[model samples]
Target: MAGRRRTKHRKLVDKIKEDQRVSSVPDEQNSAAADLPTELLERILSPLDLRNNIRAAAVCKSWQAVATSVRKSNRHPWLMICPKVGNSYDFYDPGQRETYSLDLPELKDSRICHAKDGWLLLSKARTRRIFFFSPYTLELIKLPKLQSVHEAIVFTAAPTSDNCIVFTVNHVNPMAVAVSTCRPGDDAWTTIIFENQLPFVSGICTKIVFSKGRFYCLSEPGWLGVYNTNNGIWAVLSVPPPKCTEYLPPDYWWKGKYMAEFNGDIFVVYTCGAVNPFVYKLDETKQVWVEMRSLGGMTFFANFLSSHVRVDLKGKMRDNVYFSKVLYYGKRCVTYSVDRDRYYPRKQLYDWGEEDPFQSVWIEPPEDA
Candidate 1:
């Protein structure tokens, strides 16, 4: 009996020793991983998606430093769904098809005029006050109240930058426009009344884009107005509008127009009911609009207020045009492939004429968001 008892005690002791040895291996491995070089750590975390990169930063201070350094690399823009009746805003990541909700009371009674460089330019109707808001950091930078309502508003760069300029144009008369300009620290806006040499009418339907120190404003009638910020020269370009408008109905023509700038090139997109959208790029040398069959591996996100472009996106996202409309049931956004010349997730019959430009917007989220 004593011998059997001794044998049982020896076996139990051996089992406990083996269990301890197995557990210690992980700790040893973790210590080695934690001691990895900063460059190696960056390499490990660099390829992760935005969400995963953020989560990895929470592991330790060393990881946080490495992650922050690499977070500003290429990233897709997120769709911001503003609330119609509440303070909760939903942000959708199209890459992951995930939605995140944020309670932002500051956005109440405010209209988003433009989105760029991870900042939103908003205006309050009652106060007629325009401001820049960073959703990620909840930072608000206020600007002077406008004397009159702006038909359209845009900014050259992020509001935090010193070179940032806010520009707006409104119709003072049928042949003249009231141009307003201001910087971040300015107490008041400088207003200039320019009489158009041509019958260029500015209104709420106007689309504006800034490139190469110039602001190109597209009127509802498809006229191009160029404003040079550096030289203070404003003129109506003589170039005729794209010929694609001939195929669109007159009633839907103004609603389907969207303008964007990519790497100093201006692009115009037109959409109609159940029809493939038309794309045109400006030929600066020829001073004419050229129809494009392919976007050359670039993806465009079109919204009523503002539009954005990305190059060399992966998978179906490449050579496609994404609209602000999202299919709620399937949690998928409506994208038109420039290559296939059809809408994704099957053919979609969308009357972009019925879409309210202010319902939702495509916003580039900050790296730290």
Candidate 2:
């Protein structure tokens, strides 16, 4: 009886141990054993960035269909210009939950600006190489040698009668307006140089802008000029009211800006602790410029110390998202954005970093609000 009881006890313990071992196994393994169907894969791949979506499509047939459809719809994809981190800019397409990281092996110590019509201009300060990126389809165009001076090179593309863009480079003290073409991957950059010396390279950012195939320039002590690209003609522009840049009543916070463009028209917003910013327009028919009415009243810097506006447009801007560097994050530059009343402001966006993002523009993530 005792032997029989001992054997029964051993059997009970062995059964208990087996049950414990089986229960200890992970649930994920069992779920994986069932295998993911096509429905699950579709759910997983959508909502990624543009670059990633492209790669995912190449993996198989089913994924390819999803990526192609999202791209065809023309939804805006988030583009990131990170060089030291790795090669190529990271394009994130939220419409399709996917990311495509294109390889840019030539990018070393390069600074990148906004992407216009899929081509992004990258300037490497050293050897003067312009690596172009077709951010949409991962197409890259490497340009030939050009002047790699200290001045930051800005990029803009437009559709015109000639169907080519004018590439202009300017420093703080505007020197010569060096013009290049709209072709991103071209080696030959022909110059339509400015004949005159740029007045102020040391003072604030004196600049020249192109709008509707017409180029307009801003100089010191309230000087503005317009350039015609088609005929290579140039002329002077009128001035806004001069301000007392010396004294501030301690109640005002305004930093004046020369005429900036919003939707192919010229505008200048003056500040002397005043919020009623004014705008001017280039009357295309009259061949003259006219100062429009005050836009919105008194706007000041939120930090109360630095007042700078670095303006650029975002995706298909019908004057919608206007990008600015209003929020400086303890670096040489800060970025911020605001909406203009009744004005179709293009993308005025900014992306700031903890350290001096060097000259790279920082765009804020959408959910920060």
Candidate 3:
């Protein structure tokens, strides 16, 4: 009786295993998804946001191609924020209204600078090493060493381009400033010294902007300089003295001057303490800085570090100045409309917590990505 019972139990166990194997056959056959057409797959992936689209690319070869094709038409600039806790950064996608975190061990303790073409210039805090990195692809390209780059730095084009040029300026003598230029693959940087026709007693450059195939800079005490990259020529533009009707001193104009370019024109913004900003646009044909009655369809984003950005929103954000520092001093951020001349606090932009104090800069999302 015991032998008969053992035989019966063995047969029951074998039947259960065979049924389980048969049930998994349909699951394996359905997993490949070979029947789905590429066009339909892209259409399905089109509605998803950028982060989800990245995940869909990892599904299979066919899905990867479809996801890549779909993402090309849906790209937007994301706000990057680095937190204090870990080796990662969070990007806020305003279009999707979502924040995605990217794990970038390479950006650990890095100071960011000069963002262009979806690439950010990073300098390691401890080493002061300068490099360019793409947050989307985690690609890093190292550049040669630069020292004493106090205020202004800019690039001619995207770092990956063959004709890309990087330029930076620093104070050499009391009245002179030195400009340094280099390409991505170059062995060393070439330095150019500009000491002639110094406009101010201390010609320290606060910011640099590359516009109309040339580099324009604003120095301390409201002096504007333009550098012709093609001919290696530098000239200082004669700016009229600050128009002050009050009892305030002349030193008030020296503090808050920044330069930016928009729609083939250059603009200069000066903010002294908490007064309404005074904006001037360079009239190239006249060789003068003309005070703009209105910004028309452009907005100027200026920072205390002398970095400024110009954006053309058609008529959406026109006639406004968005500054990283608040009026009346402090580091609070706000935007002021030149037309309405009203101040709007921009605390909502600081949704992502920062490791250091909050400062915002505008960067263009890379088109190639």
- Please tell me which predicted candidate would have the highest TM-score against the true structure: 1
* Candidate 2: segments with Cα more than 4 A from true spot: 1-107, 148-162, 169-187, 192-194, 197-208, 219-222, 240-263, 268-369
Candidate 2 lDDT over residue span 1-369, tens digit each:
999999999999999999888886654454553355656665666665544666777755555765566532222323243645766654333223244455766555766633334355566766777666544444666666775342333344522113545354443225444444444445577665554433422122344456776766554444555567667665554443234323334333123443445456565443332233334455656654464443332121211111112222223232222222222221112211224433222233221112233333322223321
Q: Using alpha carbons, what is the TM-score of model 3?
A: 0.65
TM-score of each: 0.80, 0.45, 0.65
Candidates in descending lDDT order? 1, 3, 2
What are the runs in model 1 whose C-alpha is more than 4 Å off? 1-73, 328-330
> Cα lDDT of all candidates, in order?
0.86, 0.43, 0.64
Expressed as tens digits, the lDDT of each residue in 1-369 for candidate 1 is 999999999999999999999999987876776788999998999888655777888866778889878874356789998888899998988777788888999889999999999899999999999999988889999999998888789999999898799998888787788888999999999999999988888888899999999999999878899899998888888878889888887776687788999999999998888578899999867879999999887889988988998874545577888888778753888988877888875655787878888988889976775
How many pairs in model 1 have backbone atoms within 3 A of each other, for residues 3 or more apart or on separate chains, i.e. clashes? 0
Top lDDT: which candidate number? 1
Better of 1 and 3 by TM-score: 1
lDDT of 2 at 47: 67
Model 2 has an lDDT value of 0.43
Tens digit of per-residue lDDT, candidate 3, span 26-72: 76654665458877887899897655777888877778888878773
